[model samples]
Target: MGQGADHLTSNQAQVLDHLRAANAPMTAYQLLGRMQNDRGAVAPPTVYRALKALEEAGLIRRIETLRAWAPVATVRPGVVVICDDCGTVRGVEAPGLLESLHERLVAEGFAEARKTIEVHGRCGDCAEDRA
Candidate 1:
């Protein structure tokens, strides 16, 4: 939820703000540049620290496939779709069916499904370009 922004550490808030504005996943180095351009110089470790904190808080998520990060618009269960050709990333909220599946998994002895799924493919733009 957007209200959770109030609970983040200063650096985490800054990173989340930047990624929310970005509207797409970004690598740590790219975020570093954005931070420097917007504020004064910042170290990579500082950004990584903020990122780890934000990830743990569910305020943001990492696209492990791309090694990039993006802000989580909502805390609800969802999936990350990535454009394999252009590296574009989009987060989609899972429908009720997926929720039901997760519930079934939990019933079958799985832990609460907090992990978001990641799917990679050529996005519409890239597909159209190929055509």
Candidate 2:
């Protein structure tokens, strides 16, 4: 908490740490449990506040379908891909992926739409295990 600590408040730092270390997305309630020791009296409001701060800083993102949060994979605008089998939420990365998607949407007459895509399915690990 000493080095580069001024970038975040203690609560925000604690919340980000938990999300960064998580293998899967976590709800705010779950984050409270993980941060209670550091936060000393973590509650729903406290966690929510921290989450908002982290989101504002672009350090994390909330998966609307899962109602959980995960650390942002990159600074670029991208889509969220949620693994249904393992509940892992990750950012999708592909060259010009967003642009292609936008082009398709525009062709479909949804040019004015604001896109927020979340593709749900088994991830590579689970898919391989099943095969």
Candidate 3:
């Protein structure tokens, strides 16, 4: 699906590259700082625009609660799990059952329905640390 990235603008490509290489979600300001450090003096609006374009292209997902973005690693629906203590973000590919549910929703006259399911909890490592 990200095959369309071949046409991405330079800034958009930069943003996507950073997200793809990141181990966790990143906020726009973080991306801007990285870009600025590497390329010298990047504008906040530039980073934001690139992020918007990448999101619209379905190449990234926003962790709404964290106000952060993560690269899409698969074509399947994603269930984002976030750690409250360490701020770790992980994406789980949901079962095909969700596709059927979405289809049912569309059939029930909810044509514009969109959902992003997020689960928040402490990760195993964090839990172990606490114990």
Better of 1 and 2 by TM-score: 2
When sorted by TM-score, best at the front, the candidate numbers are 3, 2, 1
* Per-residue lDDT of model 2, residues 26-65, tens digit only: 8999998887766477678988998898887777878878
Tens-place lDDT per residue, model 3, 13-77, is 88988988887788999999999988888899999999888888878878888889888773235
| Segments in model 2 whose C-alpha atoms lie over 4 Å from true places | 1-6, 37-39, 74-76, 100-114
Task: Give residue 93's error in model 3 in angstroms.
Answer: 2.5
lDDT of each: 0.78, 0.77, 0.82
Per-residue lDDT tens digits of candidate 1, residues 37-121?
9889899998999998887876877877778887777323477887778766777777886879788998989987366588888
Name the candidate, 1 or 2, with the larger lDDT value: 1
Candidate 1 lDDT trough over 10 residues, lowest sum = 70-79
The C-alpha stretches of model 1 lying farther than 4 A from their native spots are: 7-10, 74-76
